[model samples]
Target: MAARLLIGVLAVSGLGLALSLVAGTVLLRDYLYGRVAEQVSGLSQAPDVRPGAIAPSRLCEVTDAPAVLPSDFRLTVIEADGSVRCRVPGDQTGPPVPSVDELRDWADDDAAAVVRDDSGSWATSVDAFDQPGRDGGKGYVMVAISLRNADLTVQRVAVGGAAIGVVVLAVLALAGRMVIRIGLRPLTDVREAAREIRHGDLSARVPPGKPGTEVADLSTALNSMLEEIQRGFEKRRESEQRIRQFATDASHELRTPLTSIKGYAQLYAQMAARNTGSDAGTSIAREARKDVEQRRAEVVSRIDSEADRMSGIVEDLLLLARLDQQPELVKERVDLVEIAHDVLTAARAGHPERRLDLKVEGPVEVEGDPGRLQQVVANLVTNAIVHTPSAIVVAAATTDGVAVLEVRDDGPGMPAEVQHRIFDRFYRADVGRSRRSGGSGLGLSIVRALVEAHGGSLECVSSVARGSTFTVTLPRAS
Candidate 1:
């Protein structure tokens, strides 16, 4: 862009100089010749000389000459009948005057006027040498003037002027380029800062440059974005550490209770089995057996459910860690429609009571990690199944330029507040209900992370008592 601007300036400057020079030269040449012609005509009228014996008139040679610049062109005067009296180029070939077609073309064929000589250097005005005190009067005396070397001087000036113009233009263009670079240097800083950020240096920031340039504005914007990213990562790291610590603490706290319950239940079962032959012991053992069985079932269920919940949290943490380190490989394109079909098939097989409808759109394909994409779908589906445990409706659609994979359920949906935090780890809308249903709240968060890793987004649309819809939108590769 800078090169183009500089070249345009040079072109405009050259055009202007050439036009002005040509116009000024033509005007000056016309005016000078007009003045000389008028002066010569007056002199001829004053004194008439028209006889055979031509007498020399007292002509103003240097005195009548106009004030010419040092580099002005020279002129020579001669008779039309091929007799050279004075020469601009100093007639070397014995008195035959120089002839010029260009000068001849400008004047009428019969009309005598001051004209440029053949050498293109001289202008000549012929004033007839009228004999004042001689016979019969009205005779002609050819007044000749020469100016050949003067044209050479004028040409040298023009060439020098053009060369100086080119040198000045080149110097200005070079200086302008340097100024442009210095002004936009902040852009380079911003670009390098972004490069560092991509290399996992989240703290990298662009320094703002001096005022009033695009580069300064760009640097500010980049620094703002970096600040936001840095804050988000700091919060995420802190949350991850807390989650890991919480999981460990929960495991330790629950372990002792689980062991005691299982041991007591097992001991009671043995007692019931051994005392079946005795009346008192058998009656006591029979009641103890019922209590023990109830306790045992409850303890096993809690342990199993809690362990499963903890395991999901750990898996989610691992996935986030992997995502932080490096996203999944998008080495190959995957047919999104094909993966949607598999998810639908699984849903149909698993939930026979619920209607799982799969509507595949046209050739839905994306450039992403297939494994990650499928996992994103499965997570949404699982969320739909749990929320709207029955009547699952799985559908796929592509609109405009994006592919949307949805897992919808026809059960009661969540409120606005609950829905917002649904994706946050372990954030259950109904704590008691989630506990009863054996749910760990890391499912949707994991789904969000996985979907984002595939360069996709997740959204939910739900209303009171109405069905909830989870949609995954990804860019379809064309």
Candidate 2:
């Protein structure tokens, strides 16, 4: 993230710098060209050419061999005779023809200039001077200078700016790493603390020092997590204790029943082995049959009840395990209303007498795992069915960019205290009643986990004996 941040910042800066350099170069070119054009116009628009009639041979002495004389050009320059003075033919390198043409509209007596093409590339600036003749006649005088060398000045500025930008970027990157290293020092300490904690040092804590900005927030978050872990360990210990106690108590309870059943069975067997009267045999057989039947029924009931409880526990554990191991969901749009109706149809079977106030409304689609999300909805609806007293009203709709499916049951509303603990595993408001009613106590917990896995939120409102309402909100795909 840090490296990318730096690159993003530099990319923006580089672009701005490049654009500024380009604009500055263009402006400078215009300025330089304007200055040279003004000089040429000034000399050409004058009343007459003056003293110096520098020949190409002499001009080459002062200027480079690449220089051109100003009196020769393709364009017609109006001389003092009102006739066009086409290039009077000087074997000299000259200034830019474009610049000379721009200056051709000068006064009649002005030093009318022309462009000369001595070098293959004509690149220069020109100036003209008028020399007075013997009888007040006009003689044209022209001066030339090359532009190829002068324009190099503009390019240098652009190159210099680009070089400076590169230097600035290098300096920032070098200094930025040092700054980030210093900035993240506190995090390094926190990381080390976490590593040590992972290795069984539960008592380890980040030093309560003011490390720096947001270090406090990081510490607070980590501390909260550790505190939660500590509390979870305590809960597990308590749960294990309960399990052991239940195992011991259940074994003791089973032993008494087993002894009674075994004693009766043995007594019947002994009588059958000794007593040989036909009437006696029949009497013993009847008595033994009754005892065996009663014992068998009691054993079956115990096993069935306990097995149900154990199975529910296993299912809850499995659901939680799946939730923790969030697998990739096959995301696709599915109409949830159809699934809701199907679930409702199943739930109705459980409560035939109760007036099921169900409201199913939809056609709203969502991007989610269809099966898991359907399970979530089913659990929530079932929870309400078991808890609500009056009527179960389910409604599905698409609203406010979210596909909201709500199940409200007019049952006994749960108190705030019970509502707080309802989503916990093995938690039940009326434990005795819930168990008797075949409640596994994991329904709500499973519901919550499934909702979260879909990146959705589930909320419940309960009024004891009045009703409990559960609202599920999922993002709409269409």
Cα lDDT of model 1 by residue, 344-436, tens digit: 788768876767777776778788888878888877777777666657767777788988888887788889998877776656676543345
lDDT of 2 by residue, 1-478 (tens): 5577567767887788788889998999777766655555564333332234443223323332223324332112234443334332334333443433354443333333334455422222233334245355442333444444446888788789889988977887777767776767667778888898889887677755475647877887788888888788889988898668545544443454455556655655554454343343577767766665566566566655655555556666777887879866779887778778888788789778766554655487889888887888788777666655566777889989998888887666879998887776656666453334536566787888888888889887776667777888988885
| TM-score (C-alpha) between model 2 and the true structure | 0.42
In candidate 1, which residue ranges exceed 4 Å CA deviation?
A: 1-313
Q: TM-scores for all candidates?
A: 0.41, 0.42
Q: What is the lDDT of residue 171 in candidate 1?
A: 85
**Cα lDDT computed for each candidate against the true fold:** 0.62, 0.63
